[model samples]
Target: MTRRWPVVLVGPMGAGKTTVARLLADEWGVPARDTDHDVESLEGRSVADIFVDSGEAHFRELERQAVAAALADHEGVLALGGGAVLDESTRALLADHHVVFLRVGLSDAVKRVGLGSSRPLLLGNVRSRIKTLLDERSAIYESVATLVVDTDGRTPGDVAGEIGKALGERA
Candidate 1:
């Protein structure tokens, strides 16, 4: 039987969504795309620079467009930007797709990002900022995700295996 082969990965910036998505795509012999990379390519600027100059609304717009394009142009694993779920249009798209939410604790997220990564929302007061962002975004992720995987101390391969198992079951 033919199988529906699209997996959308959504989570916080440092939650290893991209890593896991790539692994899953490789394991499944499908394509992998990251929404942020798509945005940067289309906009001709880094996401950090866009946020620096035009504010988050502009970056979010680019992010939304990137997501729509990725969904339309690719048919495998897609890892969305951290704030992608905040956009209503993206959430609507996710509703019809298999979405996975990688849930990672604040401390682990902070450690993974390591006060680097040029993450705008995560700048200064890392712990509290992340906690607040998580509080705001967790519900949206939960609402859209068909499966939720906690990524604490888990390698990308392990996470991919979990997703593979879940995908097989769903099939």
Candidate 2:
């Protein structure tokens, strides 16, 4: 069967995936779920805390499970964690879904992430890390995405509108 209700937003950190997903859900009048939020809700801890306490590998496991559960639970707009696409199983689950890959360049990502923040991965030598992560994950994201969106200078509303248009045309 063809799934028609859920729209999955995938992208790098600071790419406004959550914001765009929320707007899309609101515009489409569907519920919205973020995998990061799921991890936090399940662990009773913030993402930063999860990283600091449980380590990245453990946090990634939690994220993967959360993504799967989210996919299984509802038909709505799903905003995935930035790195969720790194897992092959998650990509397969999203194969037939409406996946939008929000693309943000390195400089833009650094600016949006900000210089002073509690981002676990961005805590040390974040610029290089962001570049490295983007390079490694861009291919995976591209492979799984049904559509590509460049959100370099667009507001959430603008990006939402673009996504809606794309969805409409494809649907």
**Distance from true location, Cα of 85 in model 1, Å:** 0.6
Q: Model 1 clash pairs?
A: none
Worst 10 residues of 1 by lDDT: 1-10
TM-score to native of every candidate shown: 0.93, 0.94
Q: What are the per-residue Cα lDDT tens digits for candidate 2 across 55-147? A: 999999999999998888768899999889988899899986889999999998989988675789877788888898899989898999898
In candidate 1 the C-alpha lDDT for residue 27 amounts to 79
Over the stretch 1-171, how does candidate 1's per-residue lDDT look in tens digits?
223556899998789999998888887778899999988888788888889989999999989888988877788899999999999888887777889999988888888988655677767777778889888999889999999999989888888898888877433
The C-alpha stretches of model 1 lying farther than 4 A from their native spots are 1-3, 169-171
For residue 153, what is the lDDT in candidate 1? 90
**What is the model-wide C-alpha lDDT for candidate 2?**
0.87
lDDT of all the models against the reference? 0.85, 0.87
